[model samples]
Target: MEDFRKKLYEDIIIKQISRNNDVETAHKCIETLSRVVNNIIDSPNDERKRRLKEKSKTFQSNICGAQGGVEFLVKIGFRAKVIDFEKFYVLEHPLTDNPDSPEMEKLKVAQEILQDFLKKVKDRAELASKMQAKEKAAEELRRKAVLEKIDEDKERRVAARERLQARRKSQEEQETTINEESNSADDSADTADTTDTQSQPEQFYRAYHSSHYRQPNQKQD
Candidate 1:
C-alpha cells in the first residue's frame, strides 16, 4: 500500500543502524521485493522458462542489493554481485530461514535467489528476439510467393475462357453459313419445278387445238 518503489527490490536485513531507524525505508524495501518477485513470476518471454528447466545457458547470477549486477539493480543503489547460478537454490533461500533472527541471513539469501531467476530469463531474451525476426522474414517470403501464384492462375483462367468463347462463335458462324446454303438450293429446285409444269400445260393445249380444227374443211367439200 505504501510507496515501495523507493527500494527497488530488497528485504530489510540487519543494517548498521537500528531496525526502528529509517523505518519508512524498510517498508518500501519490502514493497519493492514483492513487486520484483511478481514481475519475474509473470514474464512475457517463453524461452526464458524453457532455459530455466534445461539449465542449458550460462548466466552471471547474483545477490540483489549487492554490486556488479544488471543496470536495473545498480540504478537502485544496491550492493549486488553476479555469481555462479548453479550454487544458488531459490527454494532454500527466501522461504526457509527464521523470520525474527537478529542476523537477517534469510533476507540476503532471498536477494540471491531472486537475482538468479532474473539472470536466467535475461540470458534467453536475445535468442528469442533473433528467432522471431527469422520467422517474420520467412512469413513475408511465403506471402509474396502465394500472391504471385494466384496472379498467374488468374491470367491462365482468363485466357482459357477467351479461347472457348472464340471457338463457340466460330461454330455458330459455320452452322449459319451451312443453313443459308441449304435454303438457297431448295429455292432453286422449287423454281425449276414450277417452270417445267407451266411449259407442259401450254404445249398440250396448243397441240389439241391444231389437230381438232382440221375437221372444219370436210363440210365444205
Candidate 2:
C-alpha cells in the first residue's frame, strides 16, 4: 500500500509540474504542501491544522487550483466534506511523529522532493536572469558602436568640407593677386605713353623756331 501511494503521489507531482509550466506557481504549491505536511506531523491533535477550507484563497490559489494539490492531500488522509454548503477537506486521522510508519515516511519523502524541486527552480531562475542581463549588455554595446560610427562619419564630412572651402579661398586669393599685378602693368604703360607725347610736342616747337629764324647765315632755296 505504501509503495502504491508513493507511485500515485509521484504521478501527481509530474502532472503538477507539467500542467503549471510556471516555476513560481509550482514553487508555491510545493511549499504549501510541505507546510501542510509539517503541520500535521508537528501537531497531530490540532484540529485546525487538519482542516482546510476549499473556498479559501490560500487553498484555491495554492492547492485547489494546482493540479496535484487536492490529490496529494487526499492521499495523505484528507476527505472532502460539506458543512452548511461550504466545502472543506478534513483529515480525520492526522499524521503522527512515527518515524517507521508509512504515512510519516511518505511525508518525509515528499518534503525531500519538494526541497530538491525548490532548489532546482531557484537555480534555473538565477541562470535565466543572468542570460537576460548578458543579452541586454550586448545590445547596449552594439548601439554604442553604431552611434560612434555615425559621429565619426559626421566628423569626416565636416573636415572634407573645410578642406574644400580652404582650397577655394586659396584659388580666389591667387586670382586677386594676378589681377592686381596686371592692373599695375597697365598703369605703367599709360604713364610712359604720356611722357613720350609731351617730349614730341617740345621737339616740334624747337624745330619750327629753328627753320624760321632771322639773323642766321643760311642758304635760301
Candidate 3:
C-alpha cells in the first residue's frame, strides 16, 4: 500500500507554495501533518488504534491511516478547511496561538478535535445501546401482558364451566324431588282403592245370614 501520509503532505506543501507563496506556513503545515501521522503510526498499542481497527471491520469507517484520519475528523464536525486543488485536497487549520506557540496550539487543536470525534462515536454507541434496552423492555412488557390476558381468559372459562355444572346439578335435583312427590301420591291412591274393595264383600255376607235366620223363627211361631 502507498504511504497516504506522504501523499497528503506533499499535496499540502505544493499547494501552500503555489497559492500562499509562504515557505514558513508550508513548513508549519508539514510539521503539523507529520505530527498527526506519527501519533497514529507510533501508537500501535493505543486504544484509539484498536477501536479504529474494529470499526474498519464492522463499518466502512476508520481513523487509522492518513487517508481516513483527516476525513474522519472532518466528518465528525472539525472545522478544518479543505482547499480542493486540481488533483488533491489540502487541509487548512487556522493558526491561532494564545500565549502558546503556534506549533503547540495546532497540535492541541488537532488533539481536541480527535478526542471530540471519539467522544461523539462513544455517545452514538451509548445511545444505540440505550434504545435497544428500551425496546427489549417494551417487548418484555408486551409478552407479560399477553400472558396475563391468557391467564385471565382461562380463569373466566373455568368459572363459567363451574357455574354451568352447578346449574345442571340444580336442575337434576329439582327433577328428582318432583318425581318422588308424584310417586308418593300414586301409592296413597292405590292403598285407598284396595281398602274399599275389601270392606264391601264382608258387609254383604253378614246381612244375608241374619235375614235367613229371622225367617225361620217367624214360621215356627
Task: For residues 46-156, write the lDDT of model 1, one tens digit per residue.
Answer: 223212211322223222222322233333322322235433212211222344542233334444544553454345455666777999999999999999999999999
Model 1 ranges off by over 4 Å: 1-123, 198-221
Estimate the overall C-alpha local distance difference test score of candidate 1: 0.44
Query: On residues 45-139, what C-alpha lDDT tens digit does candidate 3 reach at each position?
Result: 34333122223322222222223444433432233322332222222332322427443344454455434434444565577679889999999
Better of 1 and 2 by TM-score: 2
lDDT of 2 by residue, 22-75 (tens): 666776777788788778777867888888989899999988767788887876
State the displacement of the C-alpha of residue 24, model 2, in Å, after optimal TM-score superposition: 2.8
Superposed model 2: Cα runs more than 4 Å off = 5-9, 18-20, 64-66, 83-85, 143-221
